[model samples]
Target: MKPQLLPRKSPRQARSKALVTAILDATAQVLVERGYAGSSTNLIASRAGVSIGSVYQYFPNKDSLIAALRERHATDLYDTLDAVLTRRNPQSLEEKLSAIVHGWMLAHQLEPDLHRVVEQEFPFFERAHQDQIPIYRTIVERVRQLLEEHREQLLPDNLDLATWMVLQTIESLIHAATTTTPLPVHQPAAIEQQIVEMLTRYLQVVNPR
Candidate 1:
């Protein structure tokens, strides 16, 4: 059977929530500094200043802790996407694209080291679309709504395919820009502008005056 990745139980009270948060925070730190091989439940417990038993109280093993961290990270990304996609004021397609690209990059930058570790050390962390990976689908559907709202300005007849391509392009490029080194331009605004322009041109977005 596959290793148990889910937590043993969810934290209920305030103290329990705090304990769980500490464990997850420590897990992120260890994963970033030590990579997967070196990150053990013992090490994570020590980092969190908790006992091994306390760590195992919620998580069965390192895999479970990692899985929880992945969920937390996905939630953070979803929150960022929601912030842009659910704006009260209306925005042009290019404006929305810029907001999402910038917001997504900012969210990743908030934990760049941990992000790199998650993506590199545990490749499965980002394998979305299955029932286990609902965040990817959630994000895709949110973008689809945005596209539907601007259907008149959009060029693609198939919104689903266009949404997939748009997300792939942004995600692939942003991951490359953040994870890889020695990029030609390091200014985030410049990179975001380029991404927005690329998407806008691809979508054939026409903003009416």
Candidate 2:
């Protein structure tokens, strides 16, 4: 049997969307201020200036609310990355890698708190969360494509390994940059350049003159 789908929203859907957004925004504020243990549906409702029943009408429980918020945060990050990657055309390998790293760092800076909530508090809704394998796969595929286009300059038989290494290294750098305490002494551009340099050294196949 086919699975049942949820009903489509009508004109009232706009209002519902706005209400849900308000609740999620309020929830984020509360979560950052008081942590997970202190944030409750009642508090979210009060802060959102909506009825408690209204909050329940949208989110059945705290876990559901948080799961939705996590999804939203991920979608927003992806959208920003997409825009940056779409707009840039780097003339050289170094320029391309720098663009990618800078784009990622900018996205992280744009939503550090949301990223923190997802990375730190998202485990509570493990079952609700989706796998990020596709995200990593896409990054690797893009790197591989770029490498292939520059085969004359850097021909590596193991493109898969190169792509994986670059993706993993950049991912770890961003995660560390976002989570580190007391923050690092270096500026954002310095950090981005550092990541770009490290990845380029590992992935770039040197051609002996």
Give per-residue CA lDDT, model 1, range 1-209, as digits (tens): 56778899999999999999999999999998899988899999999999999998899989888888877876788898677656734477777888789778867777877877877787444456233756757878888888998998888989999998898898778877877652555687888899998998899876543
Candidate maximizing lDDT: 1
Model 2, 110-200: lDDT tens digits are 6577667656775455522344334544555676787777666664567777766676687668867876441464677777888988876
- Model 1 stretches with alpha carbons more than 4 Å out: 84-90, 129-131, 182-186, 207-209
Worst 10 residues of 1 by lDDT: 122-131
Model 2 spans > 4 angstroms off = 1-12, 125-164, 182-186, 206-209
Clashes of 1: 0
For residue 25, model 1's alpha carbon misses the true position, in angstroms, by 0.7
lDDT: worst 10-residue window of model 2: 2-11
Clash numbers, per candidate:
0, 0
Model 1 TM-score on a 0 to 1 scale? 0.87
Candidate 2 at 36: error in angstroms? 1.1
Candidate 2: pairs in clash = none
